[model samples]
Target chain A: MTKPAFIAVDWGTSSFRLWLIGEDGNILAERRSGEGMTTAAQAGFANILQAHLDAISAPLDLPVIVCGMAGARQGWVEAGYIDTPTSLAAILTGAVVVPGQSRDVRILPGLAQRAKDAPDVMRGEETQLLGAIAADAKGEQIVCMPGTHSKWVRVVDGRVTGFSTFMTGELFDVITKHSILSHAVAGAADMPADTTAFEAALKAAFEKPQLVTNLMFTARSGQLLHGTTAAGAQALISGTLIGAEIAGALSSAGQGAAITLVASGRLQTLYEEAFRSLSLPYQTIDADAAVRRGLSAAAEAIWLKNESKS
Target chain B: MTKPAFIAVDWGTSSFRLWLIGEDGNILAERRSGEGMTTAAQAGFANILQAHLDAISAPLDLPVIVCGMAGARQGWVEAGYIDTPTSLAAILTGAVVVPGQSRDVRILPGLAQRAKDAPDVMRGEETQLLGAIAADAKGEQIVCMPGTHSKWVRVVDGRVTGFSTFMTGELFDVITKHSILSHAVAGAADMPADTTAFEAALKAAFEKPQLVTNLMFTARSGQLLHGTTAAGAQALISGTLIGAEIAGALSSAGQGAAITLVASGRLQTLYEEAFRSLSLPYQTIDADAAVRRGLSAAAEAIWLKNESKS
Candidate 1:
């Protein structure tokens, strides 16, 4: 018998993506849409999955696996988290065979949080961590994902341990785009990549973080009295946010540790430079591809379960 | 001659408001518009003033005094700030008579900050201090204005002694409205007043100021696990912010002295209660009223200067 195709899904708050992969983990066809968890919550998750299924001509009996927020309380079915110090085997989201669909459907549970200092609640990333673990055949590793809220997870012997979340991206946006520093820059943000300005700002912020407020005055002060360009001010503020993030993250994570950063966006260059400046050994992983690979890994696990049941 | 009608303008970065004052300082007419300094900059100060003049049928020549950001360097003109420990008379923006117009124009200089811990800046509020001081007419006082940024100032001998700014209101808004608190709460925060929730949060924050991050968890956990409503969680966050403000301002300013709060606006009720609970004696000042009077004071200063010059 020809190997049956395995279906995979990686969904988030704003977007939904799906993939059909062969036994060798090769994606035959892929599709994405705006029907994410947020909209799905409004229309019901069952309907969202149907829309995706209608797009594929494959048999409904094919084994399917899902990751991301789809297993959140608001998702199709709550995939209960297995908690920290847990492995993939232990972090199972009980399989739910969607009624009327011949194929088995299993959704990965999200990780819920009640951390001491952080404000965010996450669900899908743990499954991705599971995928990361599955990606590597051996050895302990730490997965660092940078974005609006940066997350770092430690994996030892296939068991997920402690994790930390930082509001680095959001704070950077606020300080440069919304807060008082708006006056210090000549023009609005999204100006362009300014290496010189970025470096100047980073050095100042790292040297004396308190000067942030003081530096804000220079935006208007220079334009008003000393004549500094708005673009220069923008760079200054951006630099400060990045610099402060380095200063803050370094203090917590400490120095001289290897880090594997999962970043695949406009911020790739900036974060790469930041890691280099800190003199830390690190590697960058494609975020989109990782999510896709994670979905496939989850699907593979579901296939094993189905084989066992039969 | 009969006393001339007066105009008091309190213009800032994001808003412009003015009051038409009768000879006796009664508010005959008041108007506010979105054309704050930040937006009105393109029209030039003279054009903005003309727009206000067009709003009123009364003579354009009625003595006009301006305060707040309108007097900053990028403002119509840098009504150079009066140094600390200086009188209103000492820091007057030299009398400028509007050419081709039959009236007097006196710009009140905003206070320039020079704290070792903060950079120097101030505007229209300095004139309000002049009016606030004039209203008090007794001795010394402290003014606390809470918003995205909270300001605490010490007024002595009719001049600002020193002041500091705290990112409380804006920070609170960011955390509750834009940050993680948004998810924990059923909806966005515009948390109504709940005295018990407010007081409990106040007490907790006051007792353990450094546990701010630890305290944030309650915004979500209290609701999911402990039965606190999202609004209640939001209120607790607000309480913590104000509590942090009180703690920060006190420590920054140092204690062992009596304080009279220039209390008004949204801060009046909670701060009054906060002061009472802590046994700090303070008298409330009407903020909106103070601005009108401040405009009048600036006008009065301008008139006196002309008379002395003649």
Candidate 2:
């Protein structure tokens, strides 16, 4: 068995994932839990990491490389941010080392766009972008990483020109759970996916992105007037948000730019369906794989190569 | 004191307002309460209406003209809807008489636009529109009724053409109360209004309505990165929603059409500021007065003349 070389952690706001990478650059074991920054902050980040490592029976001195919200101001450590326009490789140099740790621990910094009119910031997604896009990739590309805060990134010749964060997923959660539409989508979770309703709503919102908020009302009004199903209403909300996001993202994107969607599971299927329904071409990249690859790149750049040199 | 002629009530989802009108068309007495349709439905709509009537010492035989959600399916009586492309005067003919009441109680029907692409229904706003626009008025007019569900009605030559409902107010409420932006807008209600932030967000959203959801994220990101005040974040959310609403509302409006804003108090001030910031010329009408006028019109049409004839 290949000996574990280092641990890679993606500690987000509400989720934690750790991969035990071997010397042969393969994942020997992995651990996933709800011990993200939010939980870890309360439970102790060190204790949580130690418990996960202990569960995997990892070597005590295994060096750890981390990404995501764990490096945020409120996270395990303040790794800070590298402001755009910056090359993807620049993220490697911005890693903040955890002082006083027995083993080597480094957290990757986030990316910030300081444009006054369109001020934006992203954490963890930078590493995903690094792994999703090749260092020497040519031309402009729009990479969509859909989640709680879906990010649309514009990469030009391996450098991130800019990006926008659409509060699509979070808004959907709040609106469906807390807004009046909550009644419209009751029992929607137990229903089957309404692809037809989703595609229709997607097309409508994409065509008239301005009418998004208005379109959302249809989830309820449609149910009242036309007897649209709970699943249909849920799909309508999801599609409308995703559709508007895609439209807004592409509005600022250069013409003929390639679309690469970095997502997995349900989000991947939904976005792929949305793109297909709208006849927009896109390539898919598994989000987990992308983040893993990104953390691997950071690990190799920061520690592995140095050991070889020594 | 002049003799009480009738009672006019605006029964909404969460509010109830009744005005005792005199023979000379003046308000003889008024009562307001939180026992709207929701409460009335549970507490007995007839009993609630009777209690309010008894408090005002209203004539036992005094007829009642009701509008808003009282006419909804779940309210006192199911006052159905009048399909659109109809005249504003047509709403008066659609009043549904409540059965088994000692006094004549009639609930006005709402307006429904059954356009498959943009299906919409308004119970209370139709009455507001009835009082805001005259029956014989000429030219195209856009009526903006800002509230929990802001309605933008397009009236062409005194006939109700179509309308759209933007979830602006409700979205603002939920996003601020339930989303990540909640922290950014904490204590904003006590802070002074941020007109500068409001205007900037308004203009940004109006220019790019598609980017509204993205712009909403700025409420949090701006606070974190730019040290924006809580009031500024609150203003940003308000401006973004209202701006997108106005943009969407006007997108379907005819060229050279005038905007008639029907709102009162805080909503009026906020919407007026939004319109002024965007430099959109608009005329204002008191929402309370408009609804009262509409209920008066309904009373005059349904019972006043009938009593004299009897």
iRMSD, per candidate, in listed order: 5.6, 0.7
- Candidate 1: residue B3 lDDT (0-100): 50
DockQ of each: 0.15, 0.83
Candidate 2 per-residue lDDT over residues A48-133, each given as its tens digit = 98889899998989899999999988898899889999999999999999888888899999999888788888999999999999
**Ten-residue segment with the worst summed lDDT in candidate 1 chain B?**
B92-101
B1-310 per-residue lDDT for model 2 (tens digits): 6888889999999999999998888999999999998998899999999999989899898999999999987888899999998999999999998999998999999998888778888999999888899989998999999999999999989999999999998999999999989999999989999999999999999999989999999887887678889999999999999889998989977537879999999999999998888888999999999999888988888877666521
Best by TM-score: 2
- The candidate 1 chain A region of ten consecutive residues with least summed lDDT is A112-121
TM-scores, in order shown? 0.72, 0.97
| lDDT digits (tens) for residues B1-310 of candidate 1 | 3354677788788888877777655777777888888887887767777777777765755777777777665676656766665665555554334345456666677655544324455666666566666643445666776555556777666666777666666666666666656676655246566667777777665654443433554676456544677677777777766775676566655565456565476777778887776566677777776667666765766564455321
Candidate 2's DockQ = 0.83
Candidate 2, residue B69: the lDDT equals 95
Q: How much is B285 displaced in model 1, in angstroms?
A: 5.5
True contacts kept of 1: 0.02
Q: Please state the i-RMS of candidate 2.
A: 0.7
Which candidate leads the pack in lDDT? 2
Cα miss at B175, model 2 (Å)? 0.4
